[model samples]
Target: MLGCIWQYFYSSFLRFWLKWFLRHITGKCELQRICAGYKQGALRTSQIGKNCNKIIILTLLRFEEDVVDCVAQIMRHKNISEQKDPMFKVNLQQCLLQISGYNTLFAAVEDLRKEVFDSENEDHEKICGDLLMPSEKLESRITKQWGNIGFQGDDPKTDFRGMGMLGLVNLNNCGCAFQCRYSYAIVGINLTEMAYSLLRSGALKTHFYNTVAGKPEMQNFHQLYCYLAYEFNKFWVDEEPESIMEFNTYREKFHDKVKVYLQEPEVALILKLDAKN
Candidate 1:
């Protein structure tokens, strides 16, 4: 028992001595700082790889203070201008790496514009699953359902002309039967818009960086979207607001909720929807 206790003390002293020696000799290595940033939520794992490319440059320069400032900015949930500031160099690097994934999602949405809903459109029926109507009344029928799903106008197909295919798939997905009434298209669209708004406001980067830290993929991005949908639906009915008119107010509140949730490293963003539950 004494031997074991001595061994533990000896190892602890060795670690302390090594850190002291390294601190004096290296003046704080970049790798160590980067690791600290990740642990403290200032630097993301996704941001580390790119930083390696500038290892020599970063190591020679002292950015330890920047890291502290960056973390402070993030914890405070500062506006996006902080993204461009030197304090968030690592955070900026992360966003740069994720640009490809963002573009992929955007291009996928744009590709939908080319797909017109006509007799040739095989997915048209598939798009309107249980929502039935006479064949000749297709346009009007589509409009009412689209309106039900939160689209405007009598000609719904025209709206899809831009991101038609991509948007249609998401809309159809929400409209599908889930617990007979839980998966409302209107709610789904609201979540989509909310996610985009977060992205636009730049708050999404922190949550997203924490989510897909090392490798940002399209699936993970979609998963985030799905999380929003699943969460917002429950939030909507739980509040029991007077009407949709109060959406803007609630939307801001939900965004703040997500920011708070992202502060924890172990907290996961998951998508689980069940009407019966």
Candidate 2:
């Protein structure tokens, strides 16, 4: 109860006066101080974003192309002088770009998720083929050979139900990128779901903000999937669950571990395919 009252008091009155006092002494607004003090990435960006007007942030989220204008507006509103602090403009612009780019990437990913996987589509066929059997051709589209890569049934198409083409794309990217010890396609699809959950919940912001300075692309998302695929395999090996049936339990444990990593300001969940130190 006291914490809640203190928070209310701070936001309602103390915060404004605190900022005013800081600006009076430092001759720098809160945003400028944040940009100057914190290094690039989520550490800087998240603080600047939190202090920004909600309306302006919403505009940037919708039209990432307007980030320059958004930053200019923020500078003007905050009474920041570019002549005195030249780097402030550049730093704040980069933060806005990273913030907006994440939203754009999520929208792009959602579009792919909504797209149904077409069996006759040559591009789709090729991606799946390259994933499951890069060295040879399938006897037929519906052949049981898909089981070799860990599809649950003779047909792989049905497996793309909830995730749609997003699952296939992630699966293909993971398969082409690494050698798997688990049921490859099944694990890839499962990891795709994991990736989607992380993206939707905004848990990926820390990783993306650290890695991509500007707009994050679909390829960035693919790289994240690869990271999860590789790390999860390593995790599975270390845990050595009784069988695949215990996947959910171990998967949740791994998810919690990754979440803990994300909480760190310097988190960058990249895949390093090498022997451990």
Candidate 3:
């Protein structure tokens, strides 16, 4: 009876550890195979490789602080009129730092433009066609789209959480020469979707390992078996949130629970009580 109880507890502990290891590497719960479709496109394409060459060149040239300041000024003028666009602003700042480290920024921007436009068109022509227009016409379009503006939903001017509008332009100007590749975009989108799933699934608890052991001869076999069974069943259970603000209000709850189980008195007491009762 004692041998069976020890075996059961040991097996349960091993399973818990295995699940924790899986969750850690896989980034929470098992994500759907949403990236399979894009994997071939991402790996087989030469577009990103070609664009990366320009990116490297631009990275080298834009290393100067003065050049970074100049680029930041340009970004501020072109993409950052409002204060609400923090993500755009942050990405622009990071790009400026990357550019300021090397002389490659200019080449990257040129390469990026080349990728975006047909070879038959000049860089100026391509930029004008895609991004710039007559001031009056631009103003008229803005007026029409004013109600559709702001940081919510799928406005092209601020879509993908404003990274599309602000980061794209600022990074391009700062010497990032890569156009959006289909595979890379798909990978990013799929990764975010998986992360959201893990967050919603309450799989966080399964990512922790716990173990208990005691003197073999003194163990109460029947009580130990029941306790191990309870722990094993509880391992897969999703915890309930008491309020909408529980994440914030109970910020340390997981850590605290772990601490209670792992600390001196609690761990021994739990085992002792299980053996006694």
Candidate 4:
């Protein structure tokens, strides 16, 4: 017990000194623009510790370190597909919800989570399309398409457990948009995992706090998901990755690119999808 107490204090002491050192150097870095707002009157001097932690997190995000692999390791014994798991790497839910710019967006995310697909409120035919047509073909088609995307077996419905209608929405968007590439569902799910990591690392709040406009919404989140899905597919092809096993490796690289993009003060979370097409 005494040893644990000493270790705790020692760790806190190191963290306190690290924050002091970072606070002094944040102004000298090229990332000064990101630190500029924290110095303003809106955020108190006492909040300097909080802002310094954010600055440190973003700096870490710019590296190619495998955040997703860390996540996978942490969730190895559990079911990520079945639960949100509080994002073990970062605790940014309250931060995201409390920030004025992100409150509406957080609310929208909450609503999306509470939502489930049903015939009463959803377009059934659109959801199935050629993917789940003719009752007899359901089993084989589900295994072929959904399994290609990492779902366990012949039904994608149960696989959407924790992801809610958001999962179905992303799947539908990608499936319809890119039928030629079997990567649509995979990329969409990959982006979802990316979103989880960014949230877990607290890196996303740093980006969102600076870039988001007044009252961000679920549409904004969906747009970001689509952007990652589309672009990461290109990144995948460019790397000519030999196997899908390289996913987390490439994901970290893609994340580093995003961090590089976020370094600009003028950057916004908005992706110009039409321009890309």
Candidate 5:
């Protein structure tokens, strides 16, 4: 029966259709699981000083049964002929969701190093060295930090835009006491743009920006000014302010105008405008 269904659906068009249907049902949950597991492992390591090996072994053991169940269900009920199968698709979705959740947890824990380690201690050096080691590396720290979890969204022609702003901001604040790769600055700018889009879409309205924007207009304007001051302090860190600065300034101005639409200052404002052309 399975073979018959497979044969019927294995044609190019049918296969493509089935693949997307399955993915749509399963993808979000899968991503959430992976991110959560990642966070749990990192939190355990940071808070309890647990070794990475133990964390990995224990995490796998805990989730092994769920993984097996998902695989079994997929093998038993997956219908190649059907574009949507609740049993197979749902189980697979759960498995992937668990993985994504783990990953998100790991990232949160990893970013807590400032609290976990002494800035001046050699322990900081050893810890980072161990984490960055080839075997210990989890899903490419740089890529993951830049929000590179693989997923295909509605746009068939493009991959889902990864965690851009939130990830980059976390990375910027990591303070790992080493010269990070130069590529990060470039990637950070790109991620900022992606984050801005998400923000505009209202997806991240409850996040950091929203928190700042939550206050009354006068208070929000004050908070925005403070944030702008911090950004200026690090302006030289990226050298070229063409991308980050422009958008940041625009946001600041927009917020100010929101507070008082017709207010004007005496000084001429030098706006480093984004090159939209």
Candidate 6:
């Protein structure tokens, strides 16, 4: 009860005066202070998003370019002077780019997820088959060979239902990059779902903000999927689970570990290819 009252009082009245006093003392608006004081990445960017006007940020969600204009507008509204704080303009621009880039990345991922995997498409078949069995030719489309790489059945098409092409893409791009100890293709697909859940929940903001200076692209998402796939594989082997039946429990443990890393300001969840050995 008291906590709710304090929150109401703070947002209703104390917040405005607090900002006014801070500006009077520091000669910087809340946004400017956030940019100046906090290190770049989720810490600073998340604060800017929280403190700024929602309408402005929401309007810029679709922005691909001209983010400078949005930053200028924010400065004008906040009465910030570029001459006094030259870095603020650049910093805020980067933050806006990261913010908008996250939305763009999510949309691209969603579109890919909606695209059903086509069994007849040569490209899809090649991508799927080559990732699991580069040297060997498949006996048939519905053969038991797919089980070699972790598919539950003879036909791998049904496995793509949840993540669609996104799962296959992650498997092909990230899974093949490493020599996995786990069931390569299916585990990659499962990890794809894990990556998707993280992206959907906005848990990757810290990692993306720290890694990508400007707008993140689809490649960035793919790279993150790669990191998760690699790290989770290493983690699974290290944990030495008694059986595959414990996958969910170990996956959750790995997910929690990754979440803890994301909470840090300097988190960059990149898979170091050189360190794979």
* Candidate of highest lDDT: 2
Candidate 4 residues lying further than 4 Å off, grouped into runs, are: 1-98, 114-152, 174-178, 199-202, 205-212, 269-276
lDDT tens readout by residue for model 4, 108-143: 565665566553444643564454332334444345
- Relative to the true structure, candidate 2 has a C-alpha RMSD (angstroms) of 1.9
Arranged by TM-score with the best first, the candidates are 2, 6, 1, 4, 5, 3
Alpha-carbon TM-score of each model against the true structure: 0.53, 0.95, 0.16, 0.51, 0.23, 0.94
Give one digit per residue, the lDDT tens place, for model 3 in 1-277: 9999888987779766865686577543211111111122212111222222344334443444644455355445444432543344343333333323212422332333234323244653334224432232333422443222221222223322322222223322321111221112212222223222321242211111112111111122222222332332233134555532443333244334533443332232132224523
Residue 10 of model 6: what lDDT? 100
lDDT of 6 by residue, 1-277 (tens): 9999999999999999999999899988888889999988788888887887778777865775657778888888878888989999999999888988888899999999989999999988888887558888998888998888888999999999999999988887776644547577777788899888889999899899888988999999999998898788778888999998898899889989988888887889988866535
C-alpha lDDT (0 to 100) for residue 48 of candidate 3? 23
Weakest lDDT window of 10 consecutive positions for candidate 2: 174-183
| Cα-lDDT of candidate 4 | 0.51
Name the weakest run of 10 consecutive residues (lDDT summed) in model 1: 55-64
Q: Is candidate 3 or candidate 5 better by lDDT?
A: 5
Candidate 5 segments whose C-alpha is farther than 4 A from its true place? 1-65, 70-114, 123-277
Candidate 2 Cα deviation (angstroms), residue 104: 0.4
The best candidate by TM-score is: 2
Q: Model 2 segments beyond 4 Å from truth? A: 61-64, 176-180, 275-277
User: Which consecutive 10 residues in model 6 have the weakest lDDT in total?
Assistant: 175-184
All candidates in order of lDDT, best leading = 2, 6, 1, 4, 5, 3
Steric clash pairs (candidate 1): 46-213, 160-164
By lDDT, is 1 or 5 better? 1
Tens digits of per-residue lDDT for model 5 on 1-277? 9998778768647866765675578652322223233333222222222211344334442444544544444344433222433343343334333343334333443333223333244554334334323244434323343222211222111221243223323333432212232323333333334333433442322222213211112222223333333333344354454553364564454444322421221111122323741
